[model samples]
Target: MRLFHSPASPYVRKVMVTAYERGVEDQIEILGSAAGPVKRDPEIVKHNSSGKVPCALLENDTPLFDSRVICAYLDSLAGREGTVYPQGADRFDVLTLEALGDAILDACLLCRYEAVLRPESLRWDDWYAGQMAKVDSGLDDLEGKWFERISGAFHAGSIAVVCALGYLDFRFSDKDWRSTHPKLAAWFAEVSERRSMKETLPKG
Candidate 1:
């Protein structure tokens, strides 16, 4: 399989992490991409209209996109050891957490694009703050409610959460989110030590 990949994209990191966990990382080909919020990559658009990184083309050239879908597809690959996406009731909880984590990433990416991608003359401080508020609220919910669920498992939910937190540290280093969410910080600390997480650390 070939993937339109970017090292700095948390979503791509999630798919890579999943691929690693499934022991199929070596089977994939990386198609370097320069995807952006304002300007899309035409080559990536051919595979996925969103023109985003983390787009995977299977052996037959069928495209899989967005982190969640790509991760699920990778997790379901034949001959994989165990699974990152479990079966039955627990699966819903895992999926819910994944959605929450992606929501945080969405807010983080929106804030990042606003502050870094948008021109200084056109940037909106209020919009930036609004998106950051969503990130903070999402973190609060994770720390307060989903801590045990996320911390207890090694599923896609945990992958998404870690990638989201990693992106925060990578791009918003000055924010000191750990100061307020110590438990989450500690959990993130431990999960980040995994080989998959270490190897796929985001780069600009």
Candidate 2:
């Protein structure tokens, strides 16, 4: 498989991490891309109309897209279905957890664009605050409700949470999220030592 990739994209990281966990990273060819909301990469558009990272083309030239789909595909490729993502009633719950993580990332990327990409004269404080509120709420929900899943299993949901928190540290290091989310912080510190997480640390 070939992947349109951006090192700085957390969604891309999600696919990469899943690939590593499935022992298929060696099989993927990384295609460099400069995907952006306004300035789309023409190369990526060939595979994904949205021009998004994590878009992939299989050996047979079949296209797959978005991090979630690609990660599931990787799980299948590894013959390890129902592992990172489970089967039955547990699947939807895990998918919901992944959605929560993605929502946090969505809000985070919006906040990042407002701060770095938007012009100073037009940046909205209200928007930034609202986005940060989502991040905070997400962290709180994970701490209160998903702590057991996060602390116990090595599933896709936990991977999403780790990548979300990793992005927070990568982009917003000055923000002291660990002070309140101590349990997550501790879990992250341990998980960071994993080969997959260390090798796939986000870079621009």
Number of the top candidate by lDDT? 1
Query: In order, what is each prediction's RMSD in angstroms?
Result: 1.3, 1.2
Colliding pairs, model 2: none
Q: Write the per-residue lDDT of candidate 1 for residues 47-134, one digit (tens) a residue.
A: 8998888899987889988889889888888454579887868889999999999999999999988888888899999999999999
Model 1: how large is the Cα RMSD against the reference? 1.3
The TM-score of predicted model 2 comes to 0.96
Backbone clash total for model 1 is 0
Pairs that clash in candidate 1: none
- The TM-score between candidate 1 and the true structure equals 0.96
Q: What is the TM-score of each candidate against the true structure?
A: 0.96, 0.96
- Tens digit of per-residue lDDT, candidate 2, span 51-122: 888899987878999899999889888885546888867788788888999999999999999999999999
